[model samples]
Target chain A: MNLAFTEIQETIRMVQMESLDIRTVTMGISLRDCIDSDFDSMNNKVYEKITSYAGQLRPVAEQVEKEYGIPIINKRISITPVAELLGHASKDQAVQLAKTLDKAARDLGVDFIGGYSALVHKGITKGDQTLLEALPEALSVTERVCASVSVATTRTGINMDAVKQMGEIIKEASELTKDANGIACAKLVVFCNPVEDNPFMAGAFHGTGEGEAVINVGVSGPGVVLNALKRHSDADLGEISEVIKRTVFKITRAGEMIGRVVAERLSLPFGIMDLSLAPTNAMNDSVAEILEEIGLERVGTHGTIAALALMNDAVKKGGAMASSYVGGLSGAFIPVSEDNGMIKGIEDGALSLSKLEAMTCVCSVGLDMIALTGDASASSLSGLIADEMAIGMINKKTTAVRVIPVPGKSEGEMVEFGGLLGRAPVMGVNPFSSEKLINRGGRIPAPLQALIN
Target chain B: MEQKRAVVSVVGKDQIGIIAKVTTCLSENKMNVLDISQTILQDFFTMMMIVDVSEAEDLAKLHDDLDKVSQELGLKIDIQLEDIFQTMHRI
Candidate 1:
């Protein structure tokens, strides 16, 4: 039966059963002109603009959820990367700017304010350099701010220097905040290809090419898809793909409807509908489980690569067919602690860092839920990040590293951050590193062959 | 000797004993499962069974028996005779 496509949420098969709804309705506000000689006034302007426009976001999202029986996951805001906002400012002033963002996000009730990002695929600008320097202090002081840096790309083989530097910076960020699995570092994303309209947290930012205002959506439903798959236990490959396509169509519809509403309500341009099956720490709702169901014994096994590629391709196909404009890194997620299956796989010797990297070549995000020992040296952690960065730079896909260096923990130990943060059993990492190799911090120019097919 | 193959596509809500019932039907009819794979499609259970039935006692009766099994198990069954199953997606 052709399900009548009405609301975007309904299109995505969103059955709002519990009190849970789509958590947030993020407003992407541009902070290009918020620069000032005095930091206080400028920060205040930035806060006022976000608070005033986005104050209505929660109420509207709730109203939509209530009216349509769909749950909106988050109500958030993305600004021009904080560095651009503080372009004309100094180092200390940048930290103060980050502080201002923290207070405003806390007061406004937005879970996280993204756009503390820098695009340095080719080279770092002056503002980007300043932002990079202030990261340790800015991240340390801020509670609700998120940051991202794109250091490499397919066109640009790898920014060995930036990748090496960020490895140190991330470890430093973790050192200051030991608890919550380095919650501050959790907010940082290292991108090879960062998109403009990703409505997800920690990476969402207003791109330079965007209009005055535009609405992008992040639709997630790993739980729903997994549940559906469970009920279709005997479907063949073709039949299974059909089922997935149908399910994703419903999920994509949900996003499209929500995005259309938010755009219309705020009088902003509606951007593309991003159909990523973003997984969380929920039980029975994991991308890894999907692989397991498809005959892979474990998530990080030899067969795991093919399994992930199949699922990722299938999900994108289904979601893309559902929505007119499907964008962003739409694929499966394989965070160790986030997906119970992945965690179990990691614990059971079914998954490994190398396998996870292979999977990330096809799936969404990279080196995520990778919890290193607090004793993991700065250069060692950098080596790990470099490996992941290498994947994205080669594949030409958007990849992010959310490495949590759990303090005072050894390998095989469990680290619990409670709800959503989930429980993670620490995995082992290579102690040895290429400090000599990584320390040679210069732009690794793009490979000429990368331009070819 | 004559060679017979069937493309068996199973689709419906997942229930217990699907594989047992379907495989039993094939086995009783002297059909050897050439290859079989299953996965869930949303809330539905789907499977494709490639069976070589050259040695079957009765082709028509086997089809009828499998149809009965399909009805009893609440599954949608499509049977494609040997030629197509051999040609499509053979690895």
Candidate 2:
């Protein structure tokens, strides 16, 4: 394989100088076959299957990192939604299963294990309700377990009942881990139109449609893209889009190659390469900075949405051109805490909760990693989620809410969740109450556009 | 047959004996250097080498050995499999 000198140098600079990394290599393992009538037996089978499939994940990822000289940031596992395997299990059994998952993740030396999830887009089944009941305890008691609830989709519309329930669930999860600054909420995501093969955490799950086992890779290069844009600082929007598309093409190609190699080594089918410009707590590694580099003085100021739309479209265009199997939330992420520029924007008073919500209309994920006031009511949370869900449901895109109501923390106070989760300022919510609207708990019927089929 | 290749890159302040030490380490590890290039740009040294490591028994050990040279020479060193470069830069 002949290569150009400039290409080699650029690759080296991207990895060494910039924080170019394969964010995650997640193995999605189906737990449908692990189900048994007896909860204890089912728990053991789930553990065994997960450990057997993911035991090699960490070592293999580390080996690849060494050989490739690119950082493979995380090795994770996403199982089939535990609710599907629960059948008629009790809340206690659900918590036990979550413990089992946490233990399996620890034993395998992985960072996080997702899919303590339920898909109740239309309505909740008995099993789904049971899992929801156990979510707060499951997430609080376990270290590595992450959970998500899908409450809306384009085809099924918004499940307002489930939305209301998730609001209370988020509050309970936060209060259960209040001493840790509501960190449990960081692991729980409420989604509309969630992807099955997403390797990113807080929302990743092995959907029912996936095979027995598969490997999905997420590549992150916000810093690399920011550096690329710095070179074209004086260029117009059209020229800037070209630079971004070219950069994303290279990044997605690298992700596909690495995903194929990792899958081959594990003897698992390669699923997809999620070319999301996932940011981190590190300086300069921010999606918000990419927006700022695209002519915004600040991330949430005027022209922010236009800039985000351009970036999101160009990323998908370039990523789709690079790999045939481009899936997951392959767009720009604007999570509040995970992005340094966003944190700065909030601190500088240039960003606000409303502005963040508006920005979600253009970005990949919606209202992520934000911290709300402790006094914010569950009704308000549901209202916020409903608005975000409507955006996704109407547009046929994936949107999620992972906001934390930090207990006893008011607006202007900071909740520090160290490491990749980062810290968030407790942004003020709308003082106006939405309790009446949220209490009208019923399904918002599928939109007119959903009748396309 | 799959081509067994690796990219070894070095960068730092211009220093003497950097390439000599790097190639000597590669040769000792049973890696055949297929191509090598280096340049001094504005008082900084940069070099890239493509090596065939088919006979090398342990890539991890080779990487560690190169790390030792990097530490001693006060340079940034990276050794990656060739497929990463090819896949990202080429069609």
Candidate 3:
């Protein structure tokens, strides 16, 4: 391969191993039309729409991945919540509708199906509660079903009732899927200030405001960024920043090209580009590998917070310069089970749930891949989620919790989601500090600290 | 009677651990690495090592084990059969 750079080669440089393109060109196919009391018609319409619109998506994405020689990891679909589609039906009916979606995704070879969800940030409506109540069974029965419950927002503060309810739902979810260590719970995400066009999951949803279909590309390049950082080992921090800025500019541009192409072909609007470092099961290219290169002996370590902070800031600085409409959670991620380096670290005694949470204080999300005991209390799980969610509220950044509570499992055991979900070694939780305070429920008021002076 | 030949290609950022880990895996697997050409481009360390596993019963096992080692050390390894490399890339 031509390694040297020339004036003409600058264009060619955008597509290389040191460059990571976005994982998916996810077309948010709105399921608003599928809303009906009759489950048959609604399910049929939803299934037909995604399979037809998304049939060509995989082939086109594969063509790009090969031609550009940059791996686009996942080809996924996000839609309106299944619960919303069954607004007119009973709660049990919505669960049936979600199974239909799971089947549709399986038929289409879409690996994971998101948007089996509810938004109870204000208060749980009958439909929202029904969806929430149906979540554990709905998520557990379906192979690829991913669920989300939104219980907080900056403008709306938080729904303490919803939070408390989710705590119970999570507990029940663990009981149902205990053998899988509540692996279904890993597919469930709780978000504060969640994004609509998120190309990542188990939290992505096709926001209500979107068109019938809009192609949103989530670009990733932690590997590419680490490769760039490798070039400047002897250089100072300022020089390092410049190196990352230049690298991120090219990576984001590659995503723009793919998104534009996919949108044009699908005859849909191009949505916002999520320039996040989404990692996969790939050996050397995962996000945890990037963190290890950041001088951490392992991913969940003492220096990880500082490393992720630099990565998060530099990625934005560079991506902002490259593209005008950079959206989504535009930061580095360290979801332990999703990444191989993290798995190895957990296996090697180099990572912990506490350290992962500490890193999330600076990075994206907190204790993301943690697997808890199935027997753990409802109030405790809520406390766990609330502790992480509070970080996002305080920092004014999007923080999410997608923990798997494994029934009959304890710390030091492993919950294997296999493949991309990987296997996460269960990390111990704090024994008893937050139980009383967490049970005492109300909206924790916004932090006065984040206010602009 | 033969040096069971295999090609190893490493593609990743230049880090201090690359050399130490690569050599260690090769030694532990009882393979003599022949003809090692290493270069650093920008920050990427690209190394091609021709390993001799003449004493081994299974070269595939060695390759797979070293693949894990390559990942732990944060490098990518491409293990090719000895005869395949000789026919292609006539440099």
Best by TM-score: 2
- TM-score per model over all chains: 0.78, 0.99, 0.78
Tens-digit lDDT track of model 1 for B23-78:
88888877888777777758877677667877976655765787899899888765
lDDT of 2 by residue, A1-453 (tens): 578789999998898878999999999999998889988899999999999988899999999888888889999999999889888899999999999999999999999999999999999999999999999999999999999999999999999999999999999999999999988999999999999999999899999999999999999999999999999889999999999999999999998888888899999999999999999998889999999999888878988889999999999999999999999899989899999899989999999898998888888889999999988898999999999999999989999999999999999988899999998888988999999989999999999989997
The candidate with the higher TM-score, 1 or 2, is 2
Off by over 4 Å in 2: none
Order of all candidates by DockQ, from best down to worst? 2, 3, 1
Residue A414, candidate 1: C-alpha displacement in angstroms:
1.2
lDDT of each: 0.72, 0.93, 0.73
Per model, the share of native interface contacts recovered reads 0.00, 0.83, 0.00
- What is the model-wide C-alpha lDDT for candidate 1? 0.72
Give each candidate's interface RMSD in Å.
Answer: 19.2, 0.7, 12.9
The candidate, 1 or 2, that scores higher on DockQ is 2
Q: What is the lDDT of residue A174 in candidate 3?
A: 76
CAPRI level of candidate 2: high
lDDT of 3: 0.73
Q: The CA-based lDDT of model 2 is what?
A: 0.93
**Candidate 3 chain A — worst ten consecutive residues by lDDT sum?**
A1-10
Chain A TM-score for each of the predictions: 0.92, 0.99, 0.90
Q: Over the stretch A1-453, how does candidate 3's per-residue lDDT look in tens digits? A: 212223112322333444455676776888887676677887788889888878888877766554333567778889886666666677677778778889888887877778888877677777787788788898888888788888776656666767777888888887888776677787888887688778777888888877888788888877677777776777766677688777777777667766776678767788877788867666566777766676778876777777778777888887787667777677777787778788888888878777777777887555676676666788877887787777777676678888777777777887788777777777667777666776677776646644555
